[model samples]
Target: MVADEKKIFGHPRGLPWLFFIEMWERLAFYTMLNVLLLYAKDFERGGLALPSGQANEIYGFYLAFVYFTPFVGGILADRMLGYRRSVLIGGLVMAGGLIAMSVPGTTFFYSGLVLLVLGNGLFKPNISVMVGNLYAAGDPKRDSGFNIFYMGINIGAFLASFLSSGIRNTYGWLMVFRVAGFGLILGVIILLLGWKVLAHADRQPEKDPNDAGFGAVAGKILMPALVVGVITYVIANKFIPDFAVTPATMGFIIGMIPVIIYFIRLPRTVSDKERPGMFALLPIYVAGGTFFMVLHLNGSAMTQWAADDTARDIAAPAAFQQDALPTYYKNAGEDVPRPAEANLVVVEDPAVVRMFGQKRMDEQTLAQITARYPELELRDFDPKAQATDFSGEEAALFQFATAIYADGKVEVVEEKDAHGVPSYSAKIPEREPALRRVAFMRKTPGGEVFPTYLVTQDSFDEIYSGYEARFGHPPEQLEPGKWLPVINPELFQSLNALFVVAFTPLIVLLFGWISARKNVTTAQKVFYGLCLTTVSLLLMALAGLASDGGAMRVSGWWLVGFYAIITAGELLISPMGLSLVTKLAPKRLVGLAMGGWFLATAFGNKFSGFFGGIQHMMSPVAFFLVLAGLAAAVAVFIRLLLPKLDAAIEGLS
Candidate 1:
């Protein structure tokens, strides 16, 4: 009976274990992500207090860097680390990064973020490779296997916000981050525990004893990269802090010149037999890169939209609130205001600066100022504390009176109501004056000191000018308390995953049933994926237009529909690409090829950021439509290349 139970599934019983591991790992990752956008946003809820445009910029760069690093991780695994060792190293590193984030300081926060980038680079692609390895070359269940794995990812993704939001709301953002880190470590240990069941998946390629180690080859790559990265980092920091991001990304893209040249030249130097497979993988890499650049916007551009533009409801239900103060505040609070004409800028002109300040405030510094605000729950502090000097990080610690504050008395607004609980709406009022000092650099006798300017957002027109060109509106201050009693904005993000988790199994089964009689080629799925992605963007554009170009906040339904449709595209292309890489890669280069695919994704993810950063430079509608057009072009290109792409897969056979 035990043997039959184990043998019940056609594939190895181990598939489910791997699926769960990935799902939880993704759950932790996405949970952190839900907070990431808000973290970048400068609100009372522990945000960095940057303009949405600027925050999105930073978010984009971080994501790009995060996805990009895996190329190195993949190479290290293939040559030196091996799948098991690489996965272990990456997972532990990622876990460490997540753990560090719990500390709640920039030093720790930035370091933790870096660790996440490195850890994800290590853990992400390697496991997918192992999944494909679980099946023999001609296994018919390969597609379904990936579908199951994708389901695992969406499940975790679906739940990440809940886990993150719950911990963050109950404790602080730090707790949620640490939770994600814990999740990564748990995933690694799970893989280790299941090692015996999954041993066949880790088989090494048949190769000469003299094959170069992945680490050694990467050292050849990273050594030069390290030198270049350090030199560029120094130069950029010294010479051009403002331009550092663009330059670094451009440099990373360009720094690959040596690596790209080496890879391109290596195929020529290698034996004729190795040539076809290597070249075939190149186009796949290109496709992977383009797809991700657009797809990964979920973390950056899309998140920005959800945070700043999309309308969300207070997670708590109306029936429960059943009171005026709560309902009135909900309608008039920040993030979502009641007066459409006032809340929505009926622009006299395109470039008017109503809510003018777009500058980002230092996290620790801003936290200090707000600490001086009158306690919403009725507590008092010295007015003198306002002038007290704080070394940024040191200042953030002063918020607790531990003496008067209740343990979790302040309810944090969420994007969704969890565990059937109605989401609440609370506006923790800030230190009322709304006046803050701004420091500027000045040439001093010794070296240089900074000067101060008190630029206040006193009116709608003043705040409006501060907004990035795209949004064409004033800052919240200009429309102060406009978002008071606000509905939970971040919740819309969860709606995307909810749809995915709810529908993925059905979609998979439906597709499987359809393919039963007539198999759907990988290329066909790719085509469908592109179509869905294109439509999703169009949906967004339509929503933007309906909002009358930021003249009003559109209904939340637009975002829901957009995500649902785009997620369908994700189901089609994302995992299929993973499965394809594993299926087509030569055994020896499997890790490396997988890494190459990740490299493409890294570039694409960065592209997502790049677009997000510059989005304010143009109208949101035009910006989205431009991408929609790009997707359509890709669809056309894929259809044209389908026969060749199909043949390549066959030739691989």
Candidate 2:
């Protein structure tokens, strides 16, 4: 049961290197992730310019596989490459993939994403084993070292958003992705240079008699799964036209059948003494799986909210800061021009909103307004900035956006410079101009409602300044409101990481005190962690309501609060789960078990994309609430069963 006996910082010296490597890896991953969707639909600005639903769905699928495949990586590394070799290979491959993603071609983009996925698989699980190797068995600092390492991961995540957004907005999308690749390369290089140092960590584990080689396993499961998945997708897409199937989703679902069966049958196949422990862990793992799905969605679903729905406008642009902080408030309307939205901003009456500060425009009416403002360049507008916008039509014939977002209003405060003194200014009559106009169709079917929005000349002048990433256009002259007051969508991606960094020390201290008091148990920490995740989700649900039904963007503080709260849960659960995997796994099957833990994580991660894909059907409040409720249920389950689970671990330990 003895692990490495070395000591550095009261723990293994090599731990820091692994810690930093993981930190950098997460940084690059989160950085590239922060702006991925925005780049996808960027169109002329080096984006694919797809529908939000499609973009989110694809995003979800990508994350799912990225996490899921690591099971295979852990296996390969344990059986053949060993942890260090696997980590090196994964890092190099990921670096190449990230670089390739910047190539700006459709093929290369997919290729890069695929490489990241495979590379992540190889590197993710084995690294955990390395961390364990740094500590002798039963060392108290083992968990603490992991917590420190976890901090490194979050540090990178916290910084990555700034790096990614700064690069993309300031430079270009290509540079942003290229920087992400550089991060991966740096991680690999650092680890390789310190190879001698980390060599004390996990080496190649012995293969079990039951361990089937890759070819035999891949042929038995992978080949058949691919063939079946393809046929199923084709048939679903064609004959059962109503039942469409995505290859990634179907392939993943079917591919898991063999793995699922393997896990289910393992307990029965193993000796009876291990049966109770294995059976007890199943629910814990399932619950953990569900929790991670919601938690991991931060990189996917929550990122969507930040990019599109959350308020991203920085209030004090250079122009407003010239005088005082309240200047933006004083000049609420006069100087703040509401710019018309281009065809590119994915909201209703984008043009009308430009004409009018906050008005409802039917699809058709908005199109007419846009056609009127033909001089404006819609192509340069950032799609992720606004929650909604003016559409191609006036918006009468069809309900273009979801009902939750159809009637949202973004606050516009204009700043007026009087006598060289700046004050808040806004356009307001005795009765505010109707920004949201629900007009009845004058035609025979007049009951059908047609909504109209405006594209005020003032609005147009203001919005165009925020977008600076396009090849020809940059928001160089920081206007009163940073152009459109569009949210810096990527900034929202960092909220969770920010919370992690902010709260990690506190949580670590809390746990340290608890363990010192002889009151802390892994099971208790895990149960509480689930509770925290539930609370975090509930906080997000509250944030949605505060948005006033998608009319206004909530404060970034809301994001900060949720992330901070949830991080406590993450600190408790993620590390504990890793420890449990190491402790409970039989030596002969530890790698596979490690893969199992990661596979559970992969399941949750993939489900995040699935949930993200169907974002339109549910309101943000409801969307987050469902997940919160699920977490609560799981927490309750864990609390009820903590005694038995603890005993099982105690016996094993």
Candidate 3:
């Protein structure tokens, strides 16, 4: 398999082919993932506007299944389709899914998520197995090869942040999905072009009489798991109706029970020599499950932290500065200035204020909306009550009225049909001086004009309360020129990938240097990684404390520090664990073993969602501390198992 011995940076030539293919695939994967939660909960940006808990549940299940499918994909590739064909099939299917997601409809969006989960199952595991195949048995370069391959993943992930931000900012969310689909297409093209170079790494399907057939595994494993999951769902609904966790989550957890039993019984069926290796993987799976449970939070709870609790008021260079979204002021500190009170039109009705959170419509738009819904009620805004010379946080008290409008940028409250598909319609009451709220307009550098509105006190929920508690008076006011650029919350998702790219080389070198002097095993590295993960969560818990359990906004630097620490831990665990799987799994069972690795990841990812779904139930400090304690407990468990894990790969590496 290692023929044509040409090397790319002292590793097999196939490394580069796999590297670039994975790079582009991850770019597409992460580009969609980073914004899924935000888009789900967004109101103004053509998003689903689902509640945070529901969105977190969806995100978690998506991530869990995406990793879960690899188990089936791995078996199919190992026993039927070779790695190369599987990779191509996955790429094409995933591209179609991304394109589907770009289409406007909840049906298309969910259908696309299903496609993504299926595609990732086929794509994710086979490629890594191919990377392992490039090196002969017990080759020292294997670990380093995995390290280099991991960089490709992070490089794509690093770029995804900017690509998602730019495409989402300039075009919209749908366009972001469209662009990601095209990126996957490019990766498939690269794979096609490098087919000959990667040929040596593609092995024929195994023909082992001793191995269990895919059908046997599916019947004994998959079908029973599904039945158990359904039964769990039914029972939970019937009995634990008031359970803190969602029934679906409880079902998923319960379903994994049989799979866990299968894994526990697996070693008994293996040859005596291979039994220890099979047993060793169980602890390794535990370690992986624990680590990913925390690491995957980037898309859920952590993203929520960035969006809601963190201060993102970093000043952009003059060329990039523009009017921020109305939601930005909700958590913005007193340092960020409020628009002049004269700029706001005061609406007495609280219901009207809630309908248009911070929206403004011009006279023509208002006239069109009123004409379309003439049966709607009308309200008159007082003309002489304009408090022109106002300053301070008190100015947020002003609310503007508007008839419903949606010309791409404008938001109108949504309605759902009997079939549960969302359609836009709001009974926006007509107001006097139709253009009152549109008095202030901000123009983008591209010369596009959009109306901006100051946040009403009701809209500035936590910020208003925090200001009132801190300073019995409204804070000092600065005029328009002193404005700060509000960084999009989704862009912060990139920090983890950025830190991975930045830290990989240093980590690789340090690990090499350490191994040269001392016999530090892969198990020890995972143990240390879990310890660091615990520390990172503790750091975030402290930040939650500083913010008074999310009553105040903290600087974005806290997020920066969190990513830096956890990424260092990620490098130690993820790639090393992948390399360890290759070293320890029986040659015939490599694909299944890889699938098993991802199955553990699926469990971890599901729990990540479980925690995220429950996030709003607890204060920030308690939430972060609970995660920190879980990580610490896992680290201790891993520490107890290190000797056995180290022994499993003792001679192989």
Candidate 4:
């Protein structure tokens, strides 16, 4: 139980306990996050099958609310619950959310997301505050401790990408959620076991006259924000329905009115001695928010690029290789093996084509229809078969067919015969799904028929047209079903965490060496981080150029390079921001200040979604250029404000 009895790699004994506790929790968190958008938009995998824009909006709102709740969590921990209890509570709730997501209904799925948001609010900021508490004021080890702590977060993230890939591929998506849920449960158990060791880091709730009470904050800031959000939703949908921003996003932005006003006025409530430090956090919040706006695109725009525009034909670990989908062949080399021609059936029926072309049915809807028609049989649509009495006329199908979706998961549409007894059509793959168009349909040896699509000639012309181009080889064809194994797009996210783990020690040593020789302020480090982010975006912009504005898939190395540059930038900003909040804020309000940092992150994450939602509006080159320009502007702004930021830090003990 004694915290000082032993050292953990030159830091407090409690550090390792907290580190692994966080590692497991983050494994669950990142596992879910990295797959969310893809799951929402996927049709072959029993996903929600939403449009890109709607999915991005949902992504933005979910992240925004997830971070936004930390504000309340921090307040509750400061005024009532201690850090340990909050962490435990948050961990358990998050586990439940993950489990709930394993259910097959949108209702359950959305409900699970809400639980995750609530649990994370309680868990995220408080655990970080505890890490800060382990170090004394002015401790030189504080930054390094946070860096180690940040490494724990990335370690989990790193594992999540691979674990998710393996699990989702082998066992399927729902199993991935179940496994993530269990991972969280294990994290909670670890925390319970280490409770005594973490005691020294837990702070008792204390009251200050200047501190805002929980009820007061809920009433003044939270309630008003909710009211504004509802009003904005209504107004946007009613009056500005065609506005570029979705109603939900519009509501989120306008709803920040109360929260923004409260923060702007927060300094006035604190004593004059503490006011400067509080004021200083405003710019830091802006910087943190801006930095994450670009960084978090890993789950949104960047992942989309990886999935669609980047070639994924490189060899992968044997264990990680998955059955390739029709989507994979879109931009693949002509040499990639395709299914045998005899195995494929071409559809000439426009009715069947339109049916396959519709948006896919989610599991929830499929379940409902199956319940309604207990005898409905699942069958694959074969246009060439005339033995069946059913006709391919569009209007005749309109009366009986409730819904039809791609893939075998929920591929039933109730059809009525002359007796009005309900039956179901066979499940068939979509003629055209997302980015690819069906060139042929394949029937597996097991008799499961599905459509396969390939890259358009335009894509081939752009990428392989020039035999002497950067790729350095002519396209070739291979025997059917002979395609090489390649990694999934989601797995690319692991690169960031891998780089973080690899680079953290180097970054720490380099910073340590520099600090020994000169006074390099934290603000200066953050400024440099922003500069690196700009460069990362520029790398992606060049990638866009290479891909000919997404006319063809480019090399996966572009994504690798992007992640490498951004990982370095992330190490500079993210952990430092966490450490900076703990150092600059008044002692009694550290939890609240930590919450504020997350709030800024929430804002930036929403903007990430915003950019992702609109990604198709501009060419990929222009899109990356805009983000790079934004990062450069933020870096310059931070440079100009460095003197004041340094003075504020110096003002601190």
Candidate 5:
């Protein structure tokens, strides 16, 4: 039946099912990731409100472990479950984790993350292995098949950002999880429906007497990893509290030692022909890891740049306005205000009045809030003083306060004394804060009135400083209730996915055209990919330079350009790496080798986080330059080894 089946896009009958399944899985994954950092740092919008460094640490560790688990999962699938069962189990587990994320509370959140990591381990590598299994040895369609499959992954990623933004904006962060969970469930259903069609690709390796069994691999790899990880953690804690490397990072690096040793010893166990291939894989692994360290910054440093440093005041398109566009905001706290809108209503709060008058503010809370607004002064409640006597800053401390309602309305409240004197009190809104628009009656070059959104006072100050320098005057303020819309930070993240979807087909065609005329080895493609990645960072470095080290926001096109450049590199390197693994790995260890690719990706992701953790300490240009230099170095190294790698890959495909 398999032999009689018609091909879809020059691939097997089962390819579409696997493609859609992967697409849906990535949709769920990217949807969750789109809002992760924002949710962690949000203060007024019911997020964890963690510091950037701490949040990035968690992000990095989560990504690292998620990729790491595939190593074990691949071994298990090879020996016991077979690819199909492992994939099914993984899909279901991931769906459950996504659903669990919708439940409120820190425990559920962390627990959900753990489940996702575990499930992805089982699902990710094995599924890719199945894709390769569908093709016979030396099939010309192999690389193209992976590319088609890769497109599916990007398609899901492309849609997720916009869809997640809409759901999060309309409902809340929790609802985003629910929607993503449903997407995964749909993917699982599709896989089940096509189970028989995909069955041919599911292989349970024939046991070889010389092959390392599951128990042996676990004891030598897993057990040693755990022991080393624990020892590293304790040592890092007791002896190196002030060390440059974090304990989590140190532990992860130490834990990988045994696995590294295992790979090093693997070539010795294989045949002489396989030995060169394995040796060639080592450099490829290093290059892959280094490349991903920059690529995965999309979730950490790049996301931060989108949130804190990009100009987002341009009007959203009508289509996006109806969905994801509406939910976008400048920061995590409040919604961008609408132009000429009166979403903020003044209301009186007696609690604020009494708290201000009685000097009942918690010292810690006062310190924290005041730290954000250093000029704010809290005056002791003077019953005899009239509200009119206080300055705007003093009045803001007690008499005037802002609160956001559940339905996204910002209210300003004023307190009245017994003598009918009005005092100002600021209230922190819970849930969604209504958009605050700042009316800037300035006209554009086209003579249309310019629109502006209310920025955080901090953001506003920075912007105003730059604006004043450029235009010779501060922007005119609008009367109360008037505002301009600000763009949501998460919306910027969609650009990379968008570029991937838009360009993948073109890139594929171009590469095919080139491949037909001239032999372009996978190693050569990866080398070019590294060069493009370096250029992407260099573009960012230029943006930073133009912005004077992030003293002001840069244009959104900077991000667009960066994503476009890097995504081209991604298309070249990432999918090619997967294809290379399937081509190079011995048939018996295909799944395990695929796991090795993901493991390298895991390390790169960890490095991305480590780089992000220190982002606050360095200027933007310096940070970007450092990454560019690393990528450039790797590109050079790959160039030096291209000859040997090309020779090793000869006749393999």
Candidate 6:
């Protein structure tokens, strides 16, 4: 009992171990997420290069299933394996999955995903239950303890982004997966170390006579659900193959109907006193799902924005610039060569050279380029000479000579003798022609002038055209003497976690100060969280508008600001939701209720993907405004239920 009664940081001795384990687990999870979208969309960099919609659909299904399996895992933990054993098994399985993901081939990729989903199901819910178990029935410290644990989750997430970026940039994408696997393995070791300390918290509750056993629950709930899901999938595929949403998402939404019914019927079987709380949970579940649908876009739509529409040239340390930047930009082929020392030596208007020298182009420049290169196509041209005789935007239509010979003068070998020697010399043009040229004065150690040319490819025209149409201008041009470091787009994904780490304490203190003045209920905090999330989306909508419907790139600060607001909302909603479930659910049904919470989360995550998949189909402003409206509506709906929810919370503490 003394060992069980041990306290650390004013909570159970096991709390820190659980916190560490969850932290590492999240590190592994988020590391994978940080690179997932990029990996799916990248083509030249040895990635799958799937369409945005397909990639988003896959992301959504994986997220949904990952959360959905916890329902079964929680039930198994409650009735069969105790919490510790379940946690151990889940950790190991998840670690293995992460490792497996590093292996090449589609089979391994899908297999690893399946394992991760299964493992998360077993691990996620039971750990939260154990945290709740650590406290006594009326312990006031429970909320704070969950908050501390939640911080650990963010710490892992925050670290994961940097780690994934560093590893992928330094080594490759495959190594990132290996690192995530190793992180999970470390977490399992820590979990094992605290095995005895965690023992008292592991419980397999005795089932009441009225309770449905595992087999009945499976047959009545899971079996029927699976059948419906399969039917929905088939129907969707046969009749609506081109539906706006993926067939998998449609199937999942349809399958959830029976499970939804089961939860709805649960309150009827409970006593009158417990019924209000159980019934109140349904609305809470809906709100939580709606919130997560918007929040989890970090991996899909938001990530796409980071990759395609955000200016990522953050002033990073020199070491990162040297070591990581090259790897991030690595493609499958050899590096394209550029002239080490070259001047524009413009024969045409100097203004054209100045416009081309810009890091990004403006609308006038783009229109000029389009008009000049009306028939521009990808073609091989001499590396030593310019592709066209003209200057400025006309030059962009052809490939420029990037290679330089030892001598500054152009040599023409007109004829060769038996020994392959030049017989005679021919007249050479005064100025070497190039297709496209950008002048840059390097700031790094070399500090040499290099003229770079755009590679001729179909994507070049497509990208430029899209940019011109969206911003009513060309991409921003670079200044000759000033250079912007190219950053790995994946790095931006870390901002959310970083914001969580930075703002958690301040938000906590703010809430605590408010609660001290007026007893802030969990429901109220959740409502506040919804409002904040709406604000975050609104900020993004404004950013979209500012970007001229995502034709131009926005500043990275927009993402930072959005994440900061939403993280504050996350702190208020996510952990509080967990705590609320523990406080309100019937004692015998805590694990199931926890599963229900995750089930809602699973749906929300799935919808997050669904929305992300459709991002390209709509203008950026429309996309963000739709999400903002949904979150705002959910907030208002929750506000209407506040009185009933407050009544349900009466006497729980």
lDDT of 6 by residue, 480-550 (tens): 32224556676767777787778777877887899889988889989999999999999998888877776
Clashing pairs in 3: none
> Going through the candidates in order, what is the number of backbone clashes in each?
36, 77, 0, 4, 20, 22
lDDT of 5 by residue, 1-653 (tens): 02314677667887898999999999999999888877765533445545566678788898888888998888888888899899999999998998888876567788889999999999999999888888888888888888888989988998998887766644567788888999999999999999988987887555567779989999989899999998998999898955667787899999999998888788788888787887888888888898889988988899888767776766874223321111232221222232222222111333322232222223333344446444333334443333345453443232222221233122324533222344333333333322221112233346543222223333333334544555566545434333344556777778877887888789889988998999888899999999999999999999888767776667889999999999999888988898888888888887888888888988998988888777767899999999999999999999999999998899464
Candidate 4 scores a C-alpha RMSD against the true structure in Å of: 9.3
Regions of model 3 farther than 4 Å from truth: 2-4, 317-323, 340-457, 460-469, 475-484, 651-653
lDDT of all predictions: 0.61, 0.64, 0.76, 0.77, 0.73, 0.72
TM-scores for every candidate against the unseen true structure: 0.74, 0.75, 0.85, 0.83, 0.80, 0.78
Instruction: Tell me the lDDT of model 5 at 555.
Output: 82
Which one wins on lDDT?
4
Among all windows of 10 consecutive residues in model 1, the one with the lowest summed lDDT is 349-358
TM-score of 1: 0.74
C-alpha RMSD of candidate 1: 11.7
Alpha-carbon RMSD, each predicted model:
11.7, 13.7, 7.8, 9.3, 10.6, 13.4
Q: How close to the true structure is residue 558 of candidate 1, measured as C-alpha lDDT?
A: 84
Better of 4 and 5 by lDDT: 4
lDDT of 2 by residue, 292-349 (tens): 8887777667776665456445563321111111112111222333322321222243
lDDT of 3 by residue, 1-653 (tens): 55447887788998988999999999999999988988876654446656566678899999999999998999999999989999999999999999999876678889999999999999999999999999888788888889889999999998897788766655557888998999999999999999988888888888578778999989999999999999999999899955777688889999988778878888788888888888888888888989999999988889889877888767653322224555555656767665433233233333233344423343445554346434333443333233232333222222223333344334455544223444342233333232243223434456543333433455554344555566575645435323345677777778999999899899989988988999788889899999999999999988888888776789889899999999999998999889888888887788888999999999999888878767767888899899999889989998998888877777444
**Winner on lDDT (3 vs 5):** 3
